[model samples]
Target: MSSQCPDADNANATPATEQWTSISKHVVNSYLEANNALLAAMGFSSTAEDAPTTESAVDTTTPSPTAEIAFGDENWVMERSTDDYDTLGVGDYVRFSKPIADTDVSAFARVSGDTNRLHLESDFAEDTQFGGQIAHGTLVAGTISAALARLPGVTVYLSQDLEFTGPVRIGETVTAECEIVEELGGDRYRLHTTVIGGDDETVIDGEAVVIINELPGK
Candidate 1:
């Protein structure tokens, strides 16, 4: 879209539209330059796409050498990615599944100060439509982070946008799936994150922006 300059209020006033225009232009130009360079260094011919793309053509990811996240401890036994950050591209992802145990929900409520009766008091919830204690939405959303953390390199979360589709009850299992949807230049990547469970339904859906960086030495 072509942006028009807003009428200036004072000699020093800059137009809001113009500011946004310049910011957008700079971001695009910088991304194109950086992404192209990265691909060239990696010996790839394809460049970043306008929309999120799949990683089907590129099978760079592999299985984990060992399941560091053993079962029976946290009950987090599910998909784990063995892909390196340098090799990761669009559509790459890591998934982790963990049961929303009653204790987990209660702990989250206590620590996060979100002790809503709906999630803590079973009797209260039983009387309500839920019919039992439900887990906090944010607590379920945290699973997305847990999955993303399993990705290679040091994962630093830049932003996460989420939408809760359904509620999770104690003892129910939830799986967080995060896939790269866009290469946002440099070490930054945008992922399509979703948490689903209970009769194979989507409980929470969202997008996450993360920066995967190399360790101090390796």
Candidate 2:
């Protein structure tokens, strides 16, 4: 009788396991690519890399620092009343503006689960009082949050009171302005927040209370 070697058997199985893993990854990647294409056609932005992989591990390392303050892209417009974080007080303000696109509405709908027909289906919306599709009220109101982020320091929202005065149509540009109105004790301040659409129409009016903290290592 011939004796079987365990090392040879283990080596033989390793190649087959690796080959199967490679094939499975290829199939999964192909399916994700196709799904991403379909999502893009429906005005939703996605990529194959966005799909979670079973073998991928979460990154726990410290992030690297950047040269400038992090903000939005070139398409976004931002203006701030001050650059010094320590000098933030009453009268300090930040204005952030961007056009509400179809893709933005689609992405927001997916993220927020606010798939109301008035903000999605044009045919259904045209039959309503809006005459056409409009962006979600909360989505337009979110601009206030974006503006607050551009303030000189790290801003943490304590509370917000909002009144939806007008509707924002898709593709319309809107500007969110937040001005510090009152300096509450303990690095906290109350801000007058408003989002203005075209023709100087106020789409959203609100007030927010926030605490601004100094950036780490600053």
lDDT of 2 by residue, 1-218 (tens): 01222233332233434533544564566557666665544444485575545656443444334433243456799999899998989998999999987767766665665656567656656766889889988888989999999898899999999999988999999999999999999999999999999768998998999999998789
Best by lDDT: 2
TM-score of candidate 2 on Cα atoms, chains taken together: 0.70
lDDT of each: 0.72, 0.78
Cα error of candidate 2 at position 168, Å: 0.3
- For candidate 2, the lDDT comes to 0.78
Pick out the ten consecutive residues of candidate 1 with the lowest summed lDDT.
1-10
Clash totals, every prediction: 0, 0
